[model samples]
Target: MPSTPSIPPWDVHRPPPGHGKVFLITGGNAGIGYFIAEQLSAAGATVVLGSRNPAKAEAATASIRARVPGAQVRTVRLDLADLPSLRTAVEPLGAERLDGVIHNAGVALDDPPREETREGHELMFATNHLGHFALTHWLMPLLSAAPAARVVTVGSFAAKTERLDPDDLQSRKEYVPKRAYGRSKLAQMYFGLELDRRLRAAGSAVASVVVHPGGALDSLTPSRPPVHVRTAGARLRGAPAALLVQGKDAGAWPAVRAVLDPDVRGGELWGPRVFGLRGRPRRERVWTHLTDASAATRLWDASRDLTGVDPGRLP
Candidate 1:
């Protein structure tokens, strides 16, 4: 693929104004997703928060409205783990075109015995990878309807050194909570790149970009009332970690840039600029593990088999 020409670095504070665009962010009710919504809303984009909990989504919407005054924000009930409901989950999004979709919602099991969704897929893999994959299939029409649309997949720094086992993608043979989580995220990154490749081949206007939030610590994050609260003691304790990490708000910069930056191209990776951990967003080279076209294809094929949806077919 041809390399994208270099452009001026994006200023997080002054993102290109998004007055007329509409963006849907899965899991936008809290954490980094909340910050992504807040920033884009501040810039005048109609931001929709997709979450399983309506009340929490409302709280996030309220927080953004309070902070951004005339911000246009809405909420849609979405449960990625519940595959059958996804088609209906997006019904509220309407027939209007969608400018962007951020595949940011995910689940991480810290310890385990491993769990499975009602559909019998591993919890982490189902929610983190397959759910977004299925959702993309449903949302393609809305996305393609736009003059230019982008899909930003939020991956994890944990997946940097993790490798996926094609034979055990669901961790059926052996399931370690942390490792399972990492593999799930790695699958998401693969999907983003693969989706982009398919888009380019099909000559679609929509773009798919991937990003990772580097060391986003809640202790260092600022409070947003009902959405999140960081105590003074927490701030003091996290001050030391600040040298190498950033708050969730800062962690959201890369995804926001991927969505709004006109110069950003598909099949590219974005992350924190400083040591890939604690600075402004910068376009990073695609990781080696993520560059394996064969693995990505296998994963894509497996995802389609599991979800029964082919995202490559656009409307």
Candidate 2:
């Protein structure tokens, strides 16, 4: 890992005017994703929202259209829990060259007992990691065709407390809901860094970066009683915690910076400056272990096996 990772400064709250760039944002119908789509559209980019609910997707785009009257926005169906649905979702947009992908869709499984997806993987890992993995693989061609394309994935500060458990990648043996979610988010951050390494090694032009909201308010993660209790406890300790930290628009800033900042590099991480709890967008270095080459190689192999998609073969 570089002794000092490049941390670019940017005004994420206010993006510069776009020149008709094409952007695809998953989970764009609500919360952070919705705000990201809205901001990008307002900047004059052609926005495509990938959502599971047709009504929600339509509503999201409509809302953006209302605000940015004539904003170029479209909607597509995407269900991260179902691998087959992901494949079907990308087919329609495969032909178009994409400028960037904001992998904002994810799920936090707080339910008791471990749950699996249609592909038999742990629910949290499936939705948060594998789903985005498969989507990025399938869309590689579109990403590569662009002059300069980017792939930004949302991770979390909770990743610091979690490590990838190869033995229980699916959380089958020991299932701790919050821990599982953290592990999955950790996997995402790892994948983003590792993908950047591989892309540089393979001489691919696509740039990959990861961002964390640093305790932003997200609807994607469930806010059950236990979660709230823990959050309250943190606040009592002067930790500056919230059941959900930043507002929806503010939460989207880190990701927006990672995607739009011209100076961003592969493996770079952007997040809030304050104790990683909540603040404005700022580039920050991730833990050294996350850049472990060996772990990344193992993860790449595991992801390929799980998704049955070879990213190397992508255009």
Candidate 3:
């Protein structure tokens, strides 16, 4: 019998080549998502950028290929805000088994009275949490087929200060934009943790791990040309913030680690190394609020009802 290849020592700068592995990153065309896709592609992974816009996805793919010669990259039209579209989103993946999925896409409405999706769910909650929930369900079979696939959920630091009103998951009664956005991300964290619990109970091969990009600011991010252009003035302006917070590229580390790190287990939360805001990816203690099993279960149930996809109904 042949021994399995041993993983190389972990290096945040130069991750071990993914070779035959395939990874799907939601919103991989921009922000931290683009960096995740770029980094993973640089490491030889076949990266699929899930985006709502085809043209944007193409540009991201081109940028990645330009940066990393011979990079394997592609795009799929994925609109997380539209729940009906999710049911068929994975059909184009065309892989026998999916190695990992980084749930990196999200929406944050700054000034809003509050918005709802066409399905009438709150926009932020629909896109951030429930969309990924349904997509995960659709991707389960492909995920299950892998030797030890990982599902990485990118949460938010904004969630630290907010709590989900389980009864008002949609924020129908009183809708504050920032609070609603935070709550939506908090819901995603809950989904990630709860998914792990169910996966453990089911004896499944896939792992669900949660991660947060701490204080990822655009000004702090280095330029990625057409995708992102950080002017010198922008960099100078960002220098002060850079002391405590990191750029989007650095912000992408936790999720990338969650997906590629062999030792990373289900039910773990990872973030930045320096005060959970900057530097390398480090394992952080899960917040107490996030450990509410009752809330998690309730959110899971509500998500299933809302998304019309039960992740537990694994293929």
Candidate 4:
């Protein structure tokens, strides 16, 4: 809300009851997303953990409920890699007036060959940006139905160093894993900031904000049975790599704050206070490209053309 907003974590950090509020999180099956689900559910909110696998979603919901007795949580199958899957995943959630939707599902292609989505876009772009664009577009009504709502877009530190090449979004020309990942994340921030401008122009009550969870470590974070399982890399728990990364619980703070913090404002970017690594949430300086209206418009137009969908009348 201010040039420099002050955020004091309440719901997620203090475990204050969220009571009647309904929030949906993509990729809630594991990683940082699951911790957000647990934090919100522990605070008494009804959380819908969206994942591609029903089994995994059930495990996540069960994990939260087990930890917080009588916690209200459910699961929905959502696959961000495919557009049709996202459409089907949102159907059941449309009936309720949602308090927030955290776009946290993402994929990082490390030294892997360039891949494409079912829709024919770059794998990272589709999963990280396009799918979320389509999801938010389709769910606008339910968002509008709420007295006031928020859309928390989980972004990455990559945005600061990388910019999207509107001329070639797919990286078909030349694929570099890190650059491709950065483009997708930058596009995500563009959407979040642009959506806020559009919502304000149309007199909508919903707000959109972008946040980056500091480097989140799957192995270093606390493990909950039947949900979080250790990987081979996890065996090196106290290694430098693990030590540098924050646990999933701390990493989930920025997004959770965007959804619950009263002081957070639309169109603002927030990240961990400690150099995008591990710390409490704070108002982080945004990349210059994110402030460009023309760039945002270009991203918005291209996203619509690629998805062949709209966020309904809200636009």
Clashes of each: 0, 0, 0, 3
Every model: Cα RMSD to truth: 3.1, 6.1, 3.1, 3.6
Tell me which residue pairs clash in candidate 1.
none
lDDT by residue (tens digit), candidate 4, 218-306? 76778787787666567475457654567788899888878877778988998887777878888877768789999899889988888
Each prediction's whole-model lDDT (CA)? 0.95, 0.80, 0.93, 0.84
* Winning candidate number (TM-score): 1
Point out where model 3 deviates above 4 Å: 1-9
Off by over 4 Å in 4: 1-12, 230-244
Ranking by TM-score: 1, 3, 4, 2
Q: By TM-score, how accurate is candidate 4?
A: 0.91
Best candidate, lDDT-wise?
1
Which residue pairs overlap in candidate 4's backbone?
18-43, 51-78, 137-311
Q: Kindly indicate the candidate among 1 and 4 with the higher TM-score.
A: 1
Ranked by lDDT from best down, the candidates are 1, 3, 4, 2
Question: How close is every model to the real structure, measured as TM-score?
Answer: 0.97, 0.87, 0.96, 0.91
Decide which is better by TM-score, 1 or 2. Answer: 1
Give me candidate 1's TM-score against the actual structure: 0.97
lDDT of 1 by residue, 1-315 (tens): 999998766789999999889999999999999999999998889999999999999999999999999999999999999999998788898648999999999998898788999999999999999999999999999999999999999999999999999999999999899999999999999999999999999999999999999999999999999899999999999999999999999999999999988989998999999999989999999999899999999999999999999999987
Model 3 — which ten-residue stretch has the worst lDDT? 7-16
